[model samples]
Target: MSLSLRPARRDDAALILAFVRELADYEKLRHEVEAELADIERDLFGSNPRVFCDIAEWDGAPAGFALWFYNYSTFRGRHGIFLEDIFVRPAFRSRGIATALMRALAQRCVTEKLGRFEWNVLDWNAPAIRFYRSVGAIPLDAWTTQRVDGEALERLAAG
Candidate 1:
């Protein structure tokens, strides 16, 4: 099984979208996926992209992807990479694909001198948690994640 990682290209919009939906399905959040291919193309291939993606292929076929963006940490006083999503197809899991994808991001952090590489995983995802721990990722259990979206997000903005 030959595995390789490559930065996502403009023509990969549909593939990326498919991966996103597949991931959403795995996370049981498919109903929340409102993003369209145009949105993905605009955000990822736009002149000034705010987000980026990397595609992982196993034997020349799409196997997984990692989507991320730059974030800042006031205390660290430097930029860090925030991984929005990392997903490997079910058939491709446990094949080191996710590790490779993460390692690629970690390498970017080292090469760019970024402060940190971070991401969120659901509490119920024990397997993912174990995999993350094996890679030396420690959960910030002291912190809780918060979000405002959909109608509430619009109302908050209007306020």
Candidate 2:
């Protein structure tokens, strides 16, 4: 499959949202998705954009996307790319699209001297875990991911 990757445009919000819902469903967390296409458009293309994305097209059709953001690591004393999401529809899986997207993200790290690229995978997602292993990513077994979400996030921010 011929794949092309480029920065996503505002017009692609609907497509991006569709893919995001697909991912949420696949992960069995569809109910947690309260976001909309307008949210994506604003965060990705607004004056103070919080993130950037690159869409992947396979055979002239939207196949997947890589949404990422810059993160500062105080210990590392540098910036890194935090991969918020990378999803390729199942119909287009096993076509190296995901790998290609990761390669592009890594290349950006190297080109920009970003310290590292990081992301979290669901513990039950063996397939994704295997893929990350194949890509030479080592799991941080000693570290557990922690998060404050929803109302807790709001409460914390208000304090």
Candidate 3:
């Protein structure tokens, strides 16, 4: 099986959305998928896009994707790549696509002298945790992730 990765192009917006939805579904968070095709197109294919994506193709067929963006680190005094999402279809598992995607992004970080490469995995996802551990990722167990969105975000903004 020939597996290759390419930078996502404008025409791949729909495929990217599909991957997002599939990933959300697999995570049992499909209800959290608020992004539509237009959103994907505008954000990922718009003028001066900030976020970026990479597509993994196996034998010329789409198999998975990795979405990421640059984030600043005040301590490191440099930028890092924050991987927002990485998913490989169930059919594509055990093929090293996920690892390859991570490796590719890590390589980019190294090449660009990025301070770090980071991503979050659900605590309950044993398989994902194991995979990440295998990749030399250590959990910041003392650091808790915080978020505010929807009504909470609106309230905070209104304040």
Candidate 4:
């Protein structure tokens, strides 16, 4: 079972979108996904692209992916990685695809001297929580996530 990780190619837009939807479904947040294929292609492959994705393959067949981007840390005075999405198909579970993807990103952080690597997981995802804990990840229980979007986002903009 040869598993490898590679940077996503322009042709991987569809695969990336599929993974996004699948992950959203898993998190029970499918209704919040407003992304389209064109959005994936344009945002990931367009000029001056800010976000990026890494594809994981098992024996030359795509099995999973990790999408991430750089985020600024005002206190740290440096940039860090924010993993937007990570997913592996049901058939690919227990194959270390997820671990490999995480390792690759962590390696990137080390190599680039990035300040940190971060991602959010649903609180009720026990399995995911266990996996993350096994990876030496800590839960920031003191911090609460906040979001302002849709009508609230529009109102904020107008104000």
In candidate 2, how many Å is residue 64 off? 0.8
- Give candidate 2 misplaced runs (Cα > 4 Å): 154-159
Residue pairs in candidate 1 whose N, alpha carbon or C atoms collide under 3 angstroms: none
Q: Which residues of candidate 4, in runs, are more than 4 Å off?
A: none
Instruction: Give the CA lDDT, 0 to 100, for residue 133 in model 4.
Output: 88
Per-residue lDDT for 1-159 in model 2, tens only? 599999999999998889889899999999988988789989988898979999999988999998999999998899999998889988899999999999999999999999989998999999999999988899988999899998999999999
Best by TM-score: 3
Task: Tell me the spans in candidate 3 whose CA falls farther than 4 Å from its real position.
Answer: none
Candidates in order: C-alpha RMSD to true structure: 1.1, 1.4, 0.7, 0.9
Taking the tens digit of each residue's C-alpha lDDT, what string does model 1 give over 26-135? 88999999999999999999999999999999999999999999999999999999999999999889999999999999999999999999999999999889999988
lDDT of each: 0.95, 0.92, 0.95, 0.93
Query: Across residues 37-134, which tens digit of lDDT does each residue of candidate 4 receive?
Result: 99998989999999999999999998999999999888888899999898999999988899999999999999998898999988899998898988
**Model 4: how far is 87 from its true place, Å?**
0.5
| lDDT measured at residue 99 in model 4 versus the true structure, 0 to 100 | 94
Please give the lDDT score at residue 131 for candidate 3: 93
* TM-score of structure candidate 1: 0.96
| Whole-structure CA lDDT of model 2 | 0.92
For model 3, how does the per-residue alpha-carbon lDDT over 19-134 read when each residue is reduced to its tens digit? 99999998999998999999999998999999999999999999999999999999999999999999999999989999999999999999999999998989889998999988
